[model samples]
Target chain A: MRNRLKELRAERGWSQQDLAERLEVSRQSVNAIETGKYDPSLPLAFRIAEVFAMRIEEIFLKG
Target chain B: MAAYNLAFRRYIRRFVPLTIAYGASVALATAVIPDGAPASPGIIAIAVLPGLAVVGWLWAMARLLVELDDEYLRMLEVRKFLVATGTTLALTSIWGILELFTPAMPKLPVFFVFPLWCLGLAVGAVFNRLRFGAARCA
Candidate 1:
């Protein structure tokens, strides 16, 4: 799975740590998702979507 | 300004005292057992205490997996255990075969296996940090 997390986070003018703080996760988690090293679970995907004020499909795509 | 994780904090609080107790139990057992009367029930009770603590540690780890709430942290933990498990099993198999073939090799005590697994956890921590940039596993 690939995600637009970095782009979305960049758009918000927030660092990975800032996004992690908003999602209540470690900065490494955000970084992993951004770098395509890890995929988020459904609950976490939903949380990420909610954080960015976008739908999950808009943020993540199957690759 | 991300604060320290509260769950990890609580885990440390719970583990430290248990770890201390485990050390104390082993110390007392070692102090008492070298006198050629190591088979008595009192010595046995003291020695058994640390194993019980080991079991508790296993239980605590499982509980941590359930209660951590952070998905990425959970994934990191699961990956670590997988790495540890594979490493330990490989080591044990190799050592067992080596011991069978070599007369110079001393037999390891069965009780040492848990501590060996813990060492695997340490190795896994290193793997996690190197591969995923977690910095620390424990």
Candidate 2:
């Protein structure tokens, strides 16, 4: 899956660590998800959506 | 992140003592039980200590898996364990076949399997780093 996590984070002036803190995950996980090396689980995706105040589809896109 | 850190610290606490116990048990067992010694209950009990220590190490690892909260990190750890298991099994099978076919092949001790699995874990960590871009999550 592809995602706009990096772009969204950039827009919000949030670092990976900041996003990870909000999501209750490690910075490495945030980096991995942003780089498309890993796809977050449904619950984690939901958390990411909540963090950005956006829908999951808006943050994550089909590849 | 706090959960992961706590779990990791717990793992270290368990691992350090278990390592010392493993070494002490091995040394004590070897010193007490000489080669060609008769099988006695005392000797058997002494010999079992090392195996028990190994079991403790395994238990520590399992506990770490259970306690870790980050799903991605946990998944990476599980993948590493699977890779280690696969490597250990494949190598042992190949060695067993070689021993069966080749009379010159040296017998591989069963105790070495644990160490072999450890080496496999290192290989798996490297594989994870290369493939997943992160090996040590903690």
Candidate 3:
């Protein structure tokens, strides 16, 4: 999976840790998602989308 | 959700050290042979009890992680489970091969098997953590 998490987080002036805190995940998990090393499950993808107030498609794309 | 995660982390910090201590004691007993030769009757129970306790603690820890409102916990757990299962199967096969080649080899007791199981588990956990980048497996 690919995501614009880093860009979105940066636009909001949020560090990876800050995004992780908001998403209720570890900073490492956030990093993994941002770097495309790991893909979040559907519920977690929804949580991430919820945090950014965007549709999941906007944040993540099939890869 | 964040606070709940922090709370669970706190609980784990409190539990892990004691669990490791008990585990280490069991491992140490398995590593050393009784000075005069024969394995003692209590050795198997010694290994099995502490090993079972560690497994129980891990199950509880996984439950606590699940309660903390992160679905990724389940993914991390499933990954860890797969790794451990694969490794256990591999090691058991190797042990069986070794037994076939050396039929007179001293039988490993249940106690020795417990620590060996833990060692395999730890190796599997490390593999999962490295591959998945999550400490939850540990």
How many Å off is the CA of B8 in candidate 2? Answer: 0.6
How would you encode candidate 1's per-residue C-alpha lDDT over A1-63 as one tens digit per residue? Answer: 899999999988999989998998888889999999889889989999999999999999989
Comparing chain B with the reference, what is the TM-score for each candidate?
0.87, 0.93, 0.57
Query: lDDT per model, in order?
Result: 0.83, 0.89, 0.71
Off by over 4 Å in 1: B1-4, B35-38
Q: Which residue pairs clash within candidate 1?
A: none
Tens digit of lDDT per residue, candidate 1, span B22-100?
8888888878788678478887888789988887777777777777777788777888888888988898888888899
Candidate order (DockQ): 2, 1, 3
Residue A27 in model 3: shift from native, Å?
A: 1.4
Evaluate model 1: give its TM-score.
Answer: 0.90
Score every model by TM-score.
0.90, 0.96, 0.70
Global fold similarity of model 2 (TM-score): 0.96
TM value for model 3 = 0.70
In the range B1-138, model 2's lDDT, one tens digit per residue, is 278878889999999999899899989987888999988999989989888988999999899999998888888888888888999999999999999999999999898898898888888898899998885832
Native contacts recovered, each model: 0.56, 0.50, 0.31
lDDT, candidate 3, B1-138, per-residue tens: 475566467557756875876767666765754656555667665545666666666666566656655555555655665666677667777777777788886555444554555576677668766876666644
Q: Chain A only: list TM-scores of all candidates.
A: 0.97, 0.97, 0.95
DockQ score for candidate 1: 0.61
Worst 10-residue stretch by lDDT in candidate 1 chain A?
A: A23-32
